[model samples]
Target: MAKTKKSARATLPPSIGKVLKRLHHPLDVILLCVRWYVAYSLSLRNLEEMMAERGLEVDHSSVHRWVIKLVPLFEKAFRKHKRPVGKSWRMDETYVKVRGQWKYLYRAVDKAGNTVDFLLRAHRDKAAARRYFEKAIDRNGEPETITVDKSGANLAALEALNADRPTPIKVRQSKYLNNVVEQDHRAIKRIIKPMMGFKDFRCARIILAGIEVMHMIRKGQMQDDGIARNPAEKFYSIII
Candidate 1:
């Protein structure tokens, strides 16, 4: 019996099987719930009803738990397969309400509208800007130039980073040139608007990262191994 159990465990997909161990629902159902929640402007109860219509009795809270648990893993997998973005970055911050308080979501996109990286911070200041820049550069490599909308904090952060580098990055303060990233924020805001607001900071951070991963997949940022996949399929492919 132990040998049989060992064989069964070995047969399961390493990441998915381990991450989903002892879960109640089938993997597909859980993944479907998470993808729909992040990819659309649907609330938790809204997802509950949708699942019910299909004869599944998943609770709204359960779906929420699944999102919190699984989105980070999906984001990790997506980053590994992410395509290379351009070096000219347009960086900005947008507001997201958490527990009735507004928080800043720092985001950036390359010259071709490809996602660079994102970070959610309590305040929009030089420290937060520097953290976001460091994270972005660490993951996607340093950009040749970064365009911002005259935000002193963002410019200051770049300056601080440049002081330590032999080749400094060019910083451009131009709202006009940043129109692409500004408009790109609408897509993320649209999906989260229906949620009204997050109840806590951690929830907001993880879910926002998931949302960004979906948005990146929609923008064709994931390398598909030479096979074409729709946005939804691409999302599942991240884990499967």
Candidate 2:
């Protein structure tokens, strides 16, 4: 029983497990590959060569496909199981290049740190900002308050979207409130710097969504073990 417990402790994150079951890959093979790559920041070719030593034959590209396809699926299903976000919202944007020109991605986060919505647009003007808020409100209804940076876009966005509300929208501008969303973007920067930028906005959006899902998990705002609390920390009751 002790040996069995130690053996079970060696499995990768459950994301790798569900992904393997869904893709019909051998569990040991998939988990081993994922763990090897994540633990050491190895490339697929490196992972493939390492696995080959263990008598599991596979290609670098196949490993890449498995990680890209399944990790996000697991993360998405993981995020959907969370509690609803709070009634306050924070908003921000980051820049990316699309096709040869620069574009902007507008993002919104609820008070509980869940990414409520995002929009990648060619411009960052009043119209684009208004549309991003419009899209989020269309899905989530209006929050009690909206916090953003002192952007004309955000100002116009609230003016456009809350025109019919009884009190309209209270648009407050603050550097600190917007910091949460800005910091949320650092993970994307970390991941993308390794990839040397995305090929297109469509692909970038998918990659961003996957990264955000992972972020939500780390921030204690999303999960799948019947709660959004961190999956890594287990409390062992200590009795004197």
Candidate 3:
């Protein structure tokens, strides 16, 4: 019998081998840099200085690359372990500056403050709303009811989605009802404010993903025993 070749992803452990290959630093050090950058409101230069204090002479650019490259790996590994969020969702959009240009950041959180999903778009129209809803539903499943602000664009998007699917999702448009997601944006905004602004959209998206993942961890959204010494260590165990 002929032997079947194993796919690269299956052969490697959790896709880290591909990203970490040729790196001289230890996995723990690399993970530390990533964790600090994501979990704290620190700039790349601040992280570099912190690493230097620990006797690691890594550049800020290296830390930037680690975040941009490794965050998706961590997110992909952690998704299967994420606890299922509530079917009732609160949806909202916030504006963020990227390279002096404003972009709409669409975010959805369940009733319990668990982040469902997020999308970045250049506009806040019906098309953008529809795309955001589609991505959120595709990842977290369709919500039983979605609470949003009194935006006609959001209403149209939900209606369009309901028209195509067998299971219709109820839409509620009340500012008070959607406060959960609105409040959730503050953590991200606080972090972004220190950086002045992102240089480009790609970097903004990557950094935002890292920041959101860190927020999810803090909220206990990722699967972990309460016995770990710390959150960063708990995350390290899952990835490695």
TM-score of each: 0.94, 0.67, 0.90
- Candidate 1 C-alpha lDDT tens digits along 56-120: 99999999999998998999989899999999999999999999999999999998999999999
lDDT of 3 by residue, 1-240 (tens): 011223322344746777877566666677778888878878889988998898989999888888888888777777777888899999999999998999999999999999999988988899999999999888888789999999999999999999998979988999998888888999889877777788989888888887888788788888756666466755665565
Off by over 4 Å in 2: 1-60, 98-101, 111-114, 223-240
What TM-score number comes out for model 1? Answer: 0.94
Model 2 lDDT vs. the true structure? 0.63
The TM-score, computed over Cα atoms with residue i paired to residue i, of candidate 3 is 0.90
Model 1: number of clashes?
A: 0
Candidate 3 lDDT score at position 137: 88
> Each model's C-alpha lDDT?
0.91, 0.63, 0.83
Best by lDDT: 1
Candidate 3 colliding pairs, count: 0
- Sort by TM-score, top down from the best: 1, 3, 2
Highest TM-score, which number?
Answer: 1
Per-residue C-alpha lDDT of model 2 across residues 166-228, encoded as one tens digit per residue: 877778899887888888767656654444455677656665565555455455554345433
Q: Rank candidates, lDDT, best first.
A: 1, 3, 2
Summing lDDT over every window of 10 consecutive residues in candidate 1, give the lowest-scoring window.
1-10
